[model samples]
Target chain A: MRTASPAPSRWALRVVGLGYLTLLLLAPLVAIFYKTFEHGLAPPIEAITSTNGLHALKLSLLMVVIAVPLNTIFGIGCALLLVRHKWKGNALIDSVINLPFAMSPVVIGLALFLLYGAKGWLGPDLAEAGVEILFSVPGMVLASIFVSIPFVVRETVPVLQEIGTEQEQAASTLGANAWQTFWRVTLPSIRWGVAYGVVLTTARVLGEFGAVSIVSGSRSGETETLPLYVKKAFDNFEFPAAYGASVLLALLALTTLLAMNVLKRKEDA
Target chain B: MGISVEGAVKSFGDFQALDDVSVEVPDGSLTALLGPSGSGKSTLLRAIAGLETLDAGRVTIDGEDVSTKPTQKREVGFVFQHYAAFKHMTVFENVGFGLKIRKWDKAKIADRVHELLNLVQLPGLADRYPSQLSGGQRQRMALARALAVQPQVLLLDEPFGALDARVRKDLRAWLRNLHEEMNVTTIFVTHDQEEAMDVAGQLVVMNQGRVEQSGSAEDLYEHPANEFVMSFVGEVNRLGEDFVRPHDIEVVLEADDRTEEGVVKRIVALGFEIRVEFVLGDGTDVWVQLTRNELQRLELREGQIAFLRPVQAKSFNGSTPSDPPGASTPQGSDDGGDAEVSAAV
Candidate 1:
């Protein structure tokens, strides 16, 4: 015999949860937008359209374009290798894939610098070839990639493991070659997981700060991204421009979060 | 064409899954590989289908060697125990997958898929995905998908093992009928002896990765090759070195040189038959099945002494036999030699 919970207590619990979310999430989001246009929309719009501000937005988008696809493809490959094969040191390799998640992004940026910067390993040969990596777009992309490596692989591996190889085997027995089996059976099963991973990678690439900041050298209108622009405006006492850029960044984050929720609902359906 | 597995051996680490096993499944005949769990029946079936690579020996389908061929080229239809239908695909798509891969034309593929859905008795459900199907319907869809390629050999690894008993029985009859109509060489693995006996025209009994016996069900039941086959295929009473079935034992009031005196310990009424459990003078228990009318004529009662005689029994000179647990043990037995009477009927 079960009785319904009291309505007063249930209402109290709901109010507490909603209050916490409103205080921590809704209030800050609303405050940022409100502060961005407090003086007027003209100031924020002018600041966003400025050469430095526009270049910062373009650079951030460019970084996402360069980093997200590379990580997505490699992440899918790494996930397939981790889940579909049995070999020595598999546990060690699995742990190493998750190292980026545990380590600070700044540490990853330093490691990339040590490997690709001037006077670093392979730096002399790259210099001889007239290829610059550190303090350039390539270095920023590399840092973003390093920090976002674990998101896709972590999301895809469990899905691949759960969907097992039985359907693949059945396809093989039904006259499907390896490629056909993969394309027809395995890919469709893991498509949702891959899409979810891509969304996460996109979000992480767009908002990446610590590693990109260290690698980009924060040059104005050249390598400086949106987050860097926000920091530079704050340091230069350009409070309106900083608040406007922050508002834009917050909008992107909100859009990504909304997309994730929709994708999750679709996957569940 | 028939499937011939010649001295096939497969091993996973130190565990031998199929140890030099060989058998011939006649063309257009249905066969069953019957064994207990871990007896390598499923492994042998997979090896025949080329899903498992054999360490040694060869498999020939339709008189052609397929030992070196990959599973995709082997053209074998394999149905898994869990009915591994694609969750993302509808029944039509699942059934048409092989045809699509083989480059069948669109119209022809549609016709074949429709025919298969009809043949599997789920004609109107082709638009439903596997997740939307019941377990039995999913298995039927799996069967239809396997048959879509017109494979030379059909292999089912315990196809009905995951279904409920009633569904299993219904599907068993349906599969037998389908086999008759299709006339394709079929081999299925099952641990249920009744399933093997009822559905297979040819039965192959396996134990410990080796084939114990292979023949018609009636032949195997009537003349088992060894102790394992005797106990595995049917119910048997082991008195000393002789194995006898309950139906083959006769009970009488008088004791003779050929008869053993026993007291009835229990009587079980199983609708049409009455099973009488008796203990012999040497403390060996045996079961005898009699019709209800015969029980009334004899007026047998529990704890009453009776003389039991064997109508026919086979004597083997192999190692001592073991019985399944919960079998009635001999009362007041001091000797280490234990004989059991199985009441599997």
Candidate 2:
């Protein structure tokens, strides 16, 4: 006999889930795209090409270029340290790595500002050396790095743990040194996990505003990253510019999500 | 050159995985480290391979000390139980890994890998990844990879443990033939006594982190060093302070003055032979293996009183007469037993 269809309750549950997602997520995304091109795309294009818009886009890209790679490297290092070895303070180190996820980004920005502000500790000395960290590009990049530190490490630790150390040991027995074993055996196995982490870190770094706003000072055409610029444009009654930048950011996040799904499928296959 | 472990002692916290363990494996001999689970056999194998550092003592390969050296420099090939083939790599790349690490030329690496695949009987399957191969094929690929570097010694920790019974049997025979051809000093750890006995040129029986006995299979079977060795090597019946194999005890229908009278509790016909469980007057259970023809002629059945005589048995030291059937008999025992009926000998 043929298998029976799913029960009525199962269908009901599926419909409810779809309806909720459509209302809360899909509808808003569609509305944002529709609003950006509501006036036939000319206004949106002009708003995006303006000097303020271009500068914000360039600064956001630069911030991501700096923060994503730095965080990715640090994440992999921390993940390896947490998963590969055991010593005193291991649990403490693990908790510290995950602290970024628990603490509010706003609080993190404030903490960075307090430590690097001109009147704050280490701030006066840095200012003497002509290094303006507070309300600067470096401060924004630092805040982004702080907010996204956990993405790669969290994604990679479980994968590293699941693969275990057998292959690495086997590589060693096959006359491979520690470096060779890591490069040849361990790294290849964990590359997908690292990539997944990097994708998440990139998305978080691009969308980060709470912590970045406090640290960046949101100056026009200077420290004004895309997210801050969106807020500035909206406040200045430039809806087309704000909506246009929001579409770009959303597309970036969407591309990252698609990449993550493709990588996951490849891993499964 | 052979491998030698001198008083290797390893401990994990308070639990000792190996204690004062010393074993000498001759060059070109296939030795099996035989023991039950957690008996320190795998631990000893890892220690010899330089995977596990000993808390005390040393290991030497080819008369050179390798205890303090890293695993890579020890020239030891190791195969894991789960066949730890590089999943992302094809068979060719996997087999060539060690050679590549040693900076072998590309041409040389290809030639060696080709030869190894053929030796392991998986030739022309070089482009397949580990996940694409069957369990047996994957195990063979692991073996080929381990052999690529032409290691001085090959150490396998339960190499065929994850395979099915039929595959395990086939691989065991194939391994025996491969060893005869390669002539590399090899040591494999296995909990399967039959696998160890069938393949190993020399068998080292271990228990509770100590080597119970070490010898040829026939020597260990015919004459175990102690009660532990006697029981661990093969199935045996304990009668007082003596241990006798089921085949070594004779079953007779008539009770004589010299024979021990017992009742047959059960009979199991195992195709070629019949195994009769006998409970003696002293309440000791003994198994007697009889030929099919003998069993048919005798027509022995359950509840029938029978007479048993030890055709050949060995008395072990520290084996109490009151000791239970499954007790851990002490080590360093005397090999002497009382054989009531000496006619068969």
Candidate 3:
């Protein structure tokens, strides 16, 4: 009755998953750090509090603070519209909502610039209203919002769909009004999903550069963000400064990831 | 509240879940919509409770047209088959959900929930969450929640279907007593015939998206309106009138010698049928059932003939009054209607 045990199929799947994860995720992250720290830490450490570096870092955090919350609200609205309403063209609307994910960030920034620039169609009217949008902090915020629109929406939609309308229906049948039902039932069910989406949006907003660079016009104190500081440090051949700022961006991303993990654990519970 | 569904029709994509179904549930009487699966019984129940919208027709409760009303406005208590007690809330909170949603005072909500829990025989389980309760206990909690609202009409959809057989039986009886005690207009759906007969004052049998029959359990069993209803309601042996119970026919031996008593042509045993065989005398070829010990004592054998006689019997059609059993199967029987029983001596 002594027989040898065969390897489980799951082990092969695990190996394949680990290999792909390492290649796609670990390799690129390690490469980023390797290139940044190759020259040593002094230059990078000094660059962290330097003039352009400080401006870029402060501007980037400010942009994320504004852009992430805006996108979070917009994503929740879009997800609710798509899931709860049976309006015509919902599919088309959903496809449009996802278009930002596929479109280039530069294209998004260029589109916003075209719309909000002084010479562009609506730009003159906006200028009359004393709204300086193009090549300003507003422009950078608008670009970040446009490019990060899909995260919260995509995260919340499937969870809302899976939770179904049953819980809300039960609440309604129990005599809870529409607002009460949403507050008590619908919101609680999708809170984790919304939290996950907001975290991802915050990450994308913090790391945004391509769109921000184009619309921001590299105004150091106002429009420039952390990623732009890294780019400026690299251009100036300040290797350690760029690497240190890169590490800071990496730390922000890690924080966002940690928040997402906590939220996901709560969702599982 | 009494509920009357008038010609309700509901369709889902292509399938007609309920097709022009109509039923009247009297006030304070526990009625059961008895049918096989997919017979639109649950659909009808949902329509009354306002959980489902009818494509056509109207549902009225207590003489008010509530067909278009939302579920919350209708004030109907619905108990789902899956004991849909709130998983996150304790029993007290679950039972108090209705009052809490309506913004009832805290003291009043607590007292009502406590009373309802006691009514459901779970007075001390108020602090326990639904996840901690057993199947029967969860079901009791669900009932308590439904009743706590003091809604006008109570709707239960297969309330006992998820429990084990033994537990289901006990719950079924307990529910009967609870219904009698509460006297709220109740309509429950179940496909089990025995459960319907034991619990419901009125039984509505459905088949293939239509109502086949509706009457008391005795009316349905003894006088089924159609062949489908007859076979679905209870077990019916398909034999000649003489072979059925209530028909008086002598059981005789199969031997050619002098017949001192009834004879048995062939002997076979089934669970309920202790000893059954075909009798040979009048060429009637009727089936017979005898006690196990009587067969062992009589030493009945095969291939024997004996004198046969019929005492009294009933005709399948009630057109003719009670007549003697040996009268004979008459001609011109319009349908396959026959007596429910044939007594064999």
- Better-scoring candidate (TM-score), 1 or 3: 1
Candidate 2 residue lDDT tens string, A5-98: 5799779989999999999999999999999999987888898889999999899999889999998888888888988888888899888988
lDDT of 3 by residue, A155-213 (tens): 99999898777556666667777888777777777889999999999999999988889
Q: Candidate 3's chain A scores what TM-score?
A: 0.88
lDDT (Cα) of model 3: 0.79
Chain B vs. true chain B: TM-score per candidate: 0.88, 0.90, 0.78
Rank ordering of all candidates by TM-score, starting from the highest: 2, 1, 3
Task: Write down the lDDT that model 1 would get.
Answer: 0.88
After the best TM-score superposition of candidate 3, give how far the Cα of residue B318 lies from its true spot, in angstroms. 15
Output per-candidate TM-scores for chain A, rounded to 2 decimals: 0.93, 0.96, 0.88
DockQ of each: 0.89, 0.88, 0.37
Off-target runs (Cα >4 Å) in candidate 2 are A1-6, B258-266, B279-284, B302-305, B318-345
What are the per-residue Cα lDDT tens digits for candidate 2 across B13-44?
98999999999999899999999988899999
Q: For residues B1-345, write the lDDT of model 1, one tens digit per residue.
A: 899999989899999988999999999999999999989999999988888899998999999999999999999999999999999998999999999999999999999999999999998998999989989999999999999999999999999999999999999999999999999999999999999999999999999999988999998887677778888998889887677889888888987666778999999999889999998888888999999998998999999999887766654563344422222332231123433334231
Candidate 2 chain A: worst-modelled 10 consecutive residues by lDDT: A1-10
What's the ranking of the predictions by lDDT, best on top? 2, 1, 3
